[model samples]
Target: MLKVCHMTSVHKRYDGRILKKECVSLVNAGYDVTLIVTDNKEDEIYRGVKITSIDFHPKNRLDRILNSKKRMLKKALNIDADVYHFHDPELIPVGIILHNKGKKVIYDSHEDFVQDIKEKVWIPNCIRIVLSFLFKYYEKISAKNFDMIITVTPHIVDKFLNYHRNVHMITNYPVVNFEDRKNNKRSDCNQICFTGLISPLWEHENIIKALNIMKKDDISYTLAGPSDEDYIKKLKDLDVNKRIKYMGVVDAIGVDIIQTHSVAGMAILKYSQTVGGKIGTLGNTKIFEYMYSQIPVICSDFVLWKEIIDKWKCGICVNPNDIDSISKAITFLKNNKLEAKTMGENGRRAVIQEYNWETQEKKLLALYAQIAGERVL
Candidate 1:
């Protein structure tokens, strides 16, 4: 079997995109896949992929950026795999070194890191642009040395094509099997749902404010994801009625259960051009997740998302920051239950037809085969 080693210093061992989708697909395709991650757990085989733990988890952001990648590089070199696939931008140096040594190196650009750097709250506003420019230059130069570049969206691919000749877009779509979570049990449900990273990046406060604007005693909103205490407190203070429940760090099955009881799924992100606000720039996976769960969606009115909503009629697209717009959308879905159900079915059909991991998996395997210069399986 072809040997493949995937590495990441920031994401968890079983990150949805990395392990559940990419590594698992490679393993099933008959590749000897191994993942190196920054976890404390013992190395073990999970889903036919070897899990090698770094054990020394970084203490903070600085520690991770400065040291974690170094440890990851050490472990990667020891593996001596045929292909080195890395997931984080900080691993660019590692990828460069591997490429210099004539190893097949693939950099998976999960998002537009240059654009993402501008939105990072931790970075000083004055230096954010300068850092973005410098990194953009660095990434452009380094990317050419890699054998292949994999990106998530077409926008990202277009951006990277300016950097490297070999760029492929493989979206982070939900697995088709998630359609199994849907049922006829949500007819009388009055809850709105969101399950993913809960931070300032998304308009969580707007959702709570919209619920307040509705002033309906029966309706409730529930969200589950990893978040900080200060932000969570801020949301709790805004939610005086306790209608919003935060289930901290829910697993996949937990997400299924939450979506199973929800009337509509919320992906109302804050609008900003620098932070994935443009059309075709962002492929918000939650929209597809909600579709697969058979729930109507209430997401941002970005052109990228609006096109999908317009085509599929899966849910409502509103200016996420506008309280009245969001409230009106909630009311429409709640009052017209049959229409909402039909919208949910339309979304599910859309996913079954195109927006799915199975479709992306074929592309990923084809890319790998090209990189390896032979059929992967």
Candidate 2:
């Protein structure tokens, strides 16, 4: 039997879309899979996938910085597997070591690290720039050492195409039939909802600003996700606090509940130099969830998003950085109830037709087949 070892260096749980779908698919394909993750302690199983957590010394900054790589290298060396698949960039060095030992290694690039580094406020800009350069250099060199390269977006594929000849695009789409919940009637009030990590780049401020412009007491905004203390404080300081409702980090079911009561889903990401570069070609997860819930969407006018929204006629697209534009889009959706419903239906149809995971799964399995040298099914 073929065995595959998957690695991610930092995750509290093994529940994200990419990990979950990949685990399920690999197990069904008859591969004995082992997933290595990092947390406080070692665990045995996560949603039926075998998991091994490492015990490392020095939980502090410098210790963690030095030890994480060492622990991952040790874990990779010990695992008895036919192939080592690395999902996170931090494990690139481990991949290198495994390749030196004549092992097949797969590097999965989930995001564009060069662009993503700009959004990290904790790091000084100078350091971020230097680190970004070094990361790209190492990524190009290390990626070539891998037998296969998997990425979540075409843009990411383009980044490594010059370095690695065997590159595959495996997008992070939702699991098929996971959000088949029927659409119930929205609340009597006009409800707008936003989901995902609450951060400055997400541009919750623009949403609040748009709400304030509406000045309609009948509309309510639902902010669903974990918030940074600073960002939460900033939201509270907004003049439209009374119109906002905070529903902390929620599961898929919670999202369904919120969407059932919401008229439209908000995807108002701002075009910061940092965010613009990182998210330009990426599809946000919430957009599809919103479609699955059959709610109209108001998204930023990013090039990729515009192609999707325009092609599907799913919802309105506006400049997220412009308060007036966002407000106008919201108000239009609110006033034209029938149009909103139609747009929501169109989005659902689009997802069911093309964007759903069932369609993406074939590509995923094909990549695995190419790697394992046999058809997965």
Please report the candidate that would top TM-score against the real structure. 1
Q: Taking the tens digit of each residue's C-alpha lDDT, what string does model 2 give over 196-272?
A: 88877678887888788776685888888888887787787894647888899998789788887777899877775
Candidate 1 segments exceeding 4 Å error: 178-181, 280-282, 374-377
Please report the TM-score between candidate 2 and the true structure. Answer: 0.92
- For all predicted structures, in order, the TM-scores are 0.94, 0.92
Please list the Cα RMSD from the true structure of every candidate, rounded to 1 decimal place: 2.1, 2.6
Q: Give the alpha carbon lDDT tens digit for every residue of 310-336 in model 1.
A: 999999999876899998998898888
Angstrom error at residue 204, model 2: 0.6
**lDDT of all predictions:** 0.86, 0.77
